[model samples]
Target: MEDEIITDGKYRYIEIGEGKPIIILHGLMGGLSNFQGVTHFFPTKGYQVLVPELPIYDMPMLKTTVKNFAKFLEEFIAHKGLKDVILLGNSLGGHIGLLHTKLFPEKIKALVITGSSGLYESAMGDGYPKRGDYEFIKKKAQDVFYDPKVATKEIVDEVFATVNDRMKLVKTLAIAKSAIRHNMAKDLPNMQTPTCIIWGKQDNVTPPNVAEEFHELLPDSELFWIDKCGHAPMMEHPEQFNQILDAWLVKRGF
Candidate 1:
C-alpha cells in the first residue's frame, strides 16, 4: 500500500501501518523518500513508521540549525499527539535526534542512530561545493558508499538539483559548518534514554572509532558494527540492517 502523507502546518510526513511510533529522520541530502527501502517493512512488523521531509530538504532558504530542528521536533510530536517515540536517524538526522534527546528526554522511548554525525567533528571541508558541480557532488556521494557504483549518476544528479540554487548552497554550507562545530560527546553520558548506536565499520565519514566513543559514553547504549559497510549500511546492506534492527527490538521486548 502507498504511504499516506500527513502535515501539521509546518512539517510534512508519511505515516504507515499501526502500533508504536517510529520516526525516521533522514540525512543532509535526504527527504521522506530516502526511507523507501525500509518504510514499508516496518508497518508490516506492527509499527507506525513516520518519515518526515524536514524543512531543510525543501526549503533551502531556511537556515538549518540543530537547535531549530530540535524545536521543530518538539512541535512535531505535539502536533501528532505522539509519545514515547522511537527515533531512527542517519547522519545529520542523527545529530538532530541527539539534540532532541538532550533537550526533551521525556518525549523519547529509544534512539537508533546510524553513521551519525555530531559525536565528533565532521571531516567535510569548510563550505559547500559550488552549485551544479556534478563531479564534486558525485565524489562526495561515492565517499559514503563502500561501492563507488552505488553512488550512481542519478543520485548525484538529485544532489546537484538541490544545491543548484545559490540560496540553497548557502543554507547547505551553513548547516555543514554548524555540523562540524557541534559536539554532543560530553552530553552523551547524561542521556538516560535507551539507545542503539549502529555504524559502518568502514565508515570514512564518522569512522568506527567515533562509534566506539559513543558506546563508551552512552550509559545505556549498545553498539553494533557492520563490517564492509561504508557510511550508509541501511542503504548499502539493507538485510543486515534489518536483522540488527529486529534483534534490537527483540532485546527491548517490543
Candidate 2:
C-alpha cells in the first residue's frame, strides 16, 4: 500500500497501514521524504506509521528547542487522538522522542531511537551548509553513511533541496545551535519506558561512544550497533535495521 499524507489542522503527515501506531520522526532536515525508504516497511508487518512534517524549519522564532519540539509532539498526539504510540525517531527526531517520552510517558508504549541527537552536543559546528554549496552538502551527506559511495546523486540533490532556501538555512543554524546546548544525559536515568537504541558503529555524527553512554544512562534500554553504517541506519542499512527492529519489537511484546 502507498503512503498517504493526511492533514490535521495545520499538521501534515503520512499515515500508512493499521494496528499499533508507530510515529517516525525526521531529523533536522525536517521532512518525511528522506524516510520514505524505510517508513513503508512497517505497514506490511501490520503496524501503522505516522511521519509528521514538523514545522521547525519555518519557525525560526522557536529556535527548534527540544522542549518546544516535545510540546509540539504532545499537541500532535492530542490532535490526532493517538495513544500508546511507539516513537521511532532519527537524529533530532530522536531527541524530541526522548524528551516527549519523558514528558508524556502515558501516551507512549515504547521508544526506538536511531543515531538520535539530544544525548550529546554535535561537533559539526553551529552553522548550516551555505546555500548553493553543493560540495559542502555532498560532504555532509557522505558523512551520514559509512560507505561514502552510497551517497548517491539523488541523496545529494535531496540535501541540496532542503538547505538551499535562505530561510531554511537560518532555521537549520538555529536548530544546530540549540542542539549543541541540549544535554539529556542527566535525564536518561529517569526515563522508565522500554527503549531501544540503534547506532552506526562508524557514525561520525553521534559516534558509537555516545550510544554506549546512552545505554549506560537508560536503565531499561538495549543498545544495538550496526557495523559499516553511519548516522542514518534506517536509510543506510534498512534490511539490517528492519531485522533488528522486528526482533526488538517482538522481544518487547509489541
Candidate 3:
C-alpha cells in the first residue's frame, strides 16, 4: 500500500479500482495500511477505494483540530474531482467523516463509522504520559483490539514512534482536545445523510453504547454488531465488516 500511494503535491493517497468512490479515513494512531482488507476487497466489488494520508501531525499546532481535518478531507475530495463519495472511517477518522458530511453533505452519498469518537472523549485514550515506556505503549496499542496479537510489532512500533516524537505528541494531544470540543451530539439530528454504523461489540475504547447513541441520534442510520471485536472492526473482523458494509451499500442502492 505504501508503494502504491500517489504523491500529488502535498496530498498523498492510495486509489484502487474504478467506480463510485469510497474514500477511507484512517484514525488518530491508525495508518492507511490498517484498511488493507478494505482497500483490497472494495475495488473488486466495483467501488474506487481511496485511503488518504491525513496530516495528523503536519498542520500547524493551532490549526490541528478535528474541524480542520474535516476541511482537509473536503479539499482532498475536491482535488481528486470526486463527489457523491461514501466515507468509511474508523476512530478519529470516523469523527472527521461525520463532521465533513455535516459541513458538506452535498457531496457525500453515505457514511460508515466504526469505533468513532464524536460523542465520547475517552475514545481518544488518556494522555500518554508514559511515552518512554515501551511496555506501556505496547499494552496500550494491544488494548485497541479484542485479540491482543492483532497489534503487530509494526503497529506498536509506529504508535511508539508517534508518541515519543515531541511534535507529533503535542499535535496528537491537540487533536484529542479538539475532538472533545467538537462533540457532534447536537448536530447529528439535523444531518440527514444515510449512515452505516458497524461496531465492535467488545469495543472498550468507544464502547458499545456509543454506537447505540449514534444510531439513536442520527435520523437515518442502521447499526450492525460484530461479536468479540474491538475498536477497529475492519481490522479485527474485516470479512464481517466488508460483508455488512457491502450489503448495506447494495440495500441503500449506493
lDDT of each: 0.81, 0.84, 0.93
Q: For each candidate, give its TM-score against the true structure.
A: 0.92, 0.92, 0.98
- Rank by TM-score, descending? 3, 2, 1
Residue ranges of candidate 3 with Cα displaced over 4 Å? 1-3, 124-127
* Candidate 2 residue pairs in backbone clash: none
The Cα error of candidate 3 at residue 248, in Å, is 0.4
Query: Model 3: which residue pairs collide?
Result: none
Misplaced by over 4 Å in model 1 are 1-4, 57-63, 121-123, 126-128
Candidate 2 residue-wise lDDT, 1-254, digit = tens? 44567877889999888988999998886357667666878888889888988888646466467778888889998988899899999998998999899888999999999998887746354454667889988888787789998788887887798787777666777777777676788889998999999899999888888899989999899999899998888888988898899899988899
Once model 1 is optimally superposed onto the true structure by TM-score, how far is the C-alpha of residue 150 displaced, in angstroms? 2.3
Please give the range of 10 consecutive residues that has the lowest summed lDDT in model 3: 121-130
Please report how far candidate 1 places residue 66 from its true position, in Å.
Answer: 0.7
How well does candidate 3 score on lDDT at residue 79?
95
Question: What is candidate 3's lDDT per residue for 176-211, written digit by digit as tens?
Answer: 989999999999999999999999999999999999
Candidate 3 local lDDT, residue 251: 97
Tens digits of per-residue lDDT, candidate 1, 1-254, equal 44668876877889888999998988887656656667777788888898887677354444477767777888888889999899999988888999899999998999999988887745464454666667887887788878888777767887788778776667777777677767888898999888988899989888889899988888999999898888877787777887888789879976
